[model samples]
Target: MNSEGDLVHGRWLDAVGRDGVQQAVGLLDALSEAHTIRRLELPVHTMLPVVLRQLLLPVMIDALGLPRTRQEWGERFHRGRFSEDERDRLAHYLGPRYGDRFRLFDPQRPFAQVAGLEALNGETKTAAQLVPSVASGNNVPLFSALSEADELLLMPGEAALWLLHVHCWDTASIKTGAVGDPQAKNGKTTGNPTGPLGQLGVVVPTGETLYETLLLNTPIWADGLEPQDRPQWAWDERPAGLGCMPAAQPVWSERSATGLLDLLTFQARRIRLIACETEQGTRVHRAIVSAGDRLAQTPETEPHTAWQHTAKPKKGQPHRRPRRHTSGRAAWQGLGTLLAMTLPVESDGPYTSLLLRQIADLQRGGVLSGRYRLGVETSGLEYGTQSAVVENAIGDDLPLPLRALLAQDDGLREVLLECVDQADQVARALDGLNNDLRRAAGGDPLPRDKGSRPSARFLHGLDATMRRLLAGLRTVDEDDEELLERAQLAWEQCVQMAADREAESLLAAAPPRAVVGRTVKSGDKEFVYRSGKAVGVFRTRLASILTRVAEERSAKGEEAAAA
Candidate 1:
């Protein structure tokens, strides 16, 4: 089928066809659909046509046990609107084999009362009407949909999928518009969303082999599900705060059929099975990855603002601590810290997860690192409260020597991305320094240094060094070598500071100098007392060494300034 003829439902890929539609339908007849209730949360940039033509439509057809007809498939999976006769026919057809296997749970359904089917107002009050509340949780439509099923494939909303994929499960709100409101007068005049919609959640099965279960059983299915070679999908370690990217958030198209068709045909691609392999005659796996510009990935990040906790002043009251302003950067850091601590740590696999897939692309492009750890210092944790309804279980502490890169320029995402790409070497270099610090400190140093002096020292020095280097590097001129000289001098000063700090630590342990005075040798003069030669040598050498270092740095600074 041509991409132009693809259809979508609930922002999910459905079916694609035109001339080859019948051929695709025939292909479905051969594959037996494992009776699985699979739900999917796809991205806005998901390639609908390919996903439909390659993965989903076949699964749906087989799962429903529908006849191999393009029209029937279209009516159910593609169009999603069915006539009374069609519904009756479908029910009748599947009745013998699967009695009442399919049903919809409407949250708006009225409760059955003792007074027969008749009601006082003859109206069905929605779940919201039954229970009114300002909270998103309270407003959610709570109804039993899959309670009876012991095993069901659960897919989340787009946000939830990204969260799980990235291994970051920060609680957040999803705004969905009001549905079927009689008071809505015009198309755009509908009131704000009813409440915050939450991502679909599933109980994490417990076992020693938990990860294996997750990869195979997760609802996020692709074509060619063959178990081999340690299951292609592997967990990729991403830094904190990359989960909720606003730029690549999925947006479902609300266009007319033709417009949507154009969108599908023009801006879509998918993963196709190329081959399968067995390594060492034991592990087996399918190769389903594609190569091209068509597989370009979209960035995902959590969109959240930093909150400022301020204390209000009152008349005749003691002054309160100032509120901390939360910025976007801080929010991201928090999420990153959470994921770093929580997610599994692994290296090799088939890369089945969407998050893992994206991470691979990012790593290849040098946008993401393969290793990350939590910070030992945090601003968002509450410790010790034996109670119900606990929030933020992980105390707010991060691994010290934090590895975060913020934009030197104003908050422009493009510039920030470029900065990150260019700073890969710098990041690696600093990572080495952090490792050194970690080894020296034994664990995260932030906990021991309650005053954060070491962190402050390292960060300030790093900032100055980077800024100087960048300034010098950015300076462009044929003959002007002044900025470069300045950069070199700045780097030398940084090295000098480190050396001096080390010297100071070593000197602190030295035996205290004795203030002993020696009597001048005697022959004639009787009583001239002088300080010991050892004391004088020690003072003079130390002073000379420090003086030389200072003079050299001063001279270099002056030369650069003059130039």
Candidate 2:
């Protein structure tokens, strides 16, 4: 292991008690065992591997209107419109060893019944029955039943979804660790194939990373494969085939793509329960199979991709270079304006625009074309053009009531409200700084204790508070001079107070002599002590914010003063 990994492992070892350490080791062993079993299931020669191919084969077989019997499949393979190579491949796949693997086409294992939307009305099977179980105990039954060519498929409309969820999660887990780290060696940062943390029903609660992983796995239609190529009727014509709906495509259309994401997001919120028979009685417990379904539902749960915004890419799209947009901010601003017209009072507008803009920029940078590159800050002018527009518009100083009324009509009300709230929060945070430091020091300040000592809690709280305040200022409305002045003052005071506190804390925490490093223990948690760098890093952020705030104050102040 690398130094970083060793350090992290050591920390984990120390943090996880004796029992926890055993459990952690056992989990890793189980995961490794599962991976080994999965590898043996891979098919000999195909672009799509065994499990993925198997998952989609039943639907493909039914869609192609192939016969259930191996004899008929061989006859069709010889007679149908297939290339010589395709014919040979089909023949080999249908041969004794691999033939039974095609569950829908295997005549021996007949389905109990056909199920679809119509069947949903009368179907009584629980979600747990339809989807594969994540519980180790249930794996044996799931593998046995699902592996059978004739076993029941719950809902054809939903089967594609579950297949996608299962396949992508498996792929992601194999590449990354259990948590699905995007920065992991083989992990994909962009695209619809996120690591499988959700498939195992583990929520990391670390920003939107896990949710992004799920969206990354959404099965999109290949550019080479169009909807017209394989018409819906092709699948519908087959008799005894359960599902009538075509497989869900992420790039079908804007409406279709959005709808799929919405449905996936909804399913992500549903929890599935597995029933186990014990000696005492029947026991029902939660399983990871439904983990993706039970994702925490929220507006942010939906995944965003550049492909969703533009038409489906043509074949060879990933190999081509994308054209750049120098004045691309206008495109994003136009989208923002349209959204603002129908904006919700509580909804995030600018941030939404920001994400959209970021994706658009990524698209322009050939991100869709598979051109990997680093991104530098796009919005990096001493003062932004948007702020200038707001300043030019802020001509007259109106009454407080009139200002409030106008603010209601202003398209940027949501952004402005957030700014006001942040300023208020930071101001209040500054007022309570001493108490926070005291709390970190066990709720009692020593007589010789200086207010400058930085504790983990105090540093983290200040860091968070300052970031919020700065985010609000990013899109601060210069039109409202009164509000602008108050916000500027708050920004200045916030930076100054934070710097003073950090300096005092650093000096107070200093030992008699400087050493290479030291460790401090608080309760059971151990913290590595670095010499005053925390305070220094905190100051850098404050300095950056203050610089921007000062520029706005100077330019907008003179304009407002003249008005």
Go through the candidates in order and give the C-alpha RMSD of each one to the true structure: 24.5, 23.4
User: Which model scores highest in TM-score?
Assistant: 2
Winning model by lDDT: 2
TM-scores for all predictions: 0.21, 0.27
> How does candidate 1 fare on TM-score?
0.21
Q: Which residue runs of candidate 2 sit more than 4 Å off their true CA positions?
A: 1-171, 174-459, 463-478, 514-563
